[model samples]
Target: MDLQQMRYVVAVAETASFTRAAERCHVVQSALSHQVARLEKELGARLFERTSRRVRLTAAGEAFLPAARQALEAAERARAEVAAASGEIRGRLTVGSIPTVTAVDLPAVLRDYRGRYPQVRISLRAGSSERLVDMVRDGTLDAAFLGVPPGFRIQGVHDRELAHGQHVAVVAPDHPLAAEHEVDLRHLAEEAFVDFADGSAARAQSDQAFAAAGLRREVAFEVSGVELMARMVRHGLGVALLPATFAAELHGLRCVPITNGPVRVERLVWSRFTPSPAASAFLALLGVGAPPTAE
Candidate 1:
């Protein structure tokens, strides 16, 4: 009839004495008898035989005992599972990130997350910053890594700055500028530049920097992926200005720091109310520490 009723039936069957069963159930013997009587009536069968000396199960009661016990066990297991899911972290989390973070640091972050919550499934998607932000806004992704654009607007998103790193000049190893320890904007003003797509955060920041320096540069090529831009730079197509993470990772392309002033910061962002425990757990792993906090 109900979980409590099933539990009552199980206790009565196990103990075989109304007074003892009532004690086990933490109820008075009269109340236990009334509920058991109600269940037997509901099922249209006698569940117990009573004698002055002892109590025992009827044939129907024996047949129903295992079923009632199993039902109670199943209900308890369901409750435990739901409670665990609510309080303990375990589920699939869809994460989106820009090309630079995905290529450079995300592997370590994900590996640590996997080690911590092995039951939490992680689905990672890499895209341009704009696309990843759109995915988070549209509920397609639980969280993401993004380079927050200057004056960027999002209705219900929250972000935390994860790390600060410089934008470096990446060029072919054999290129003359690659030999320079650091590059100034004035030197690259006349050279062709490999750029992130026009609307991207990196491109926007780079444009602002060039504008501040009164330097006009040509976009010799455009690619969405920072890694691709670096590879193109390696082929001597043109030079690129990308996040230091990507530059540090590109073995074939030399990364020369650009230090006119302060370097840009990268951030991890997500919806203010992401609906996944796995997402929350991963953010917790980020844990409000210094730059590149995953470790």
Candidate 2:
């Protein structure tokens, strides 16, 4: 019913434990429980089904969760807008990015943002491009940096392309192809490959390229992180195709330009709806304009 009670409920639902939720909210367990219980009594419905070992949301809780979150977000936005009107920006900015981001120096940009708006809280999450995009669409993240295959347009969100470039073949220093000045997809197809997990957006870039070339390649190892992919290539397990900028950072690898290679497009995406004041300021820092109103 009240913001404090709603906050407690949300915290408990997220953490799935009253004890942990209380710790996160910086309150004692009993006090937090009392607030939630009081809210449940006022609503005449139990939000959570508590047990000695585990806590799960009831059907009512599941139904109430989304609106509760929206309410909290609205209250936070009200506070942020007031602060902005006073020549100060104050809000939480949650950002997500793919590990292969290269269009911008993320750490340097975040450092500058922090310096400019020390009152704002910033958090970053590293994830796959597909997941990051979903987070942006769902309001879980305020903004995100994504890399997808060239010509792929992201729907249901506002996005702008930051950079577009081709991927290069990465090989161990002693690998046979490492000595080549340049290779095409046909030649690389003969070698085993270490690539992103099958069906991931990162893997799709190469998959579409090879399919278009009327060729098929063997993916010997499937890994999640780019670091692990680099390790596999360094040990001569297999070759990999990675963004040129990202490949330049990996040691013990030879980057051979591909005559015909997959092209990746890096983009920045934000919600179609109005963004938080902090997010708007971030877009300004990047020379981007405000997001358009949702259709």
Best by lDDT: 2
Candidate 1 residue spans exceeding 4 A from truth: 1-88, 102-104, 149-151, 288-295
Give candidate 2 regions above 4 Å deviation: none
Pairs of residues at least 3 apart in sequence or in different chains that clash in candidate 1: none
> Candidate 1 residues 177-253, lDDT tens each?
97898878888776798987787676887888888888788998988766677678878999888777666777877
Highest-scoring model, TM-score: 2
Model 2 lDDT tens row, 1-295? 7999999989999999999999999999999999999999998999999999999899999998999989998999999999999999998999999998999999999999999999999999999989998999999998999999987768888899999989999999999998999999999999999999999889999999999999999999999999989988999999999999999889889999998899999999999898889999998998889987786
Taking all chains together, each candidate's TM-score versus the true structure is 0.65, 0.94
Pairs of residues at least 3 apart in sequence or in different chains that clash in candidate 2: none
Model 2 TM-score (2 dp): 0.94
lDDT of 1 at 246: 62
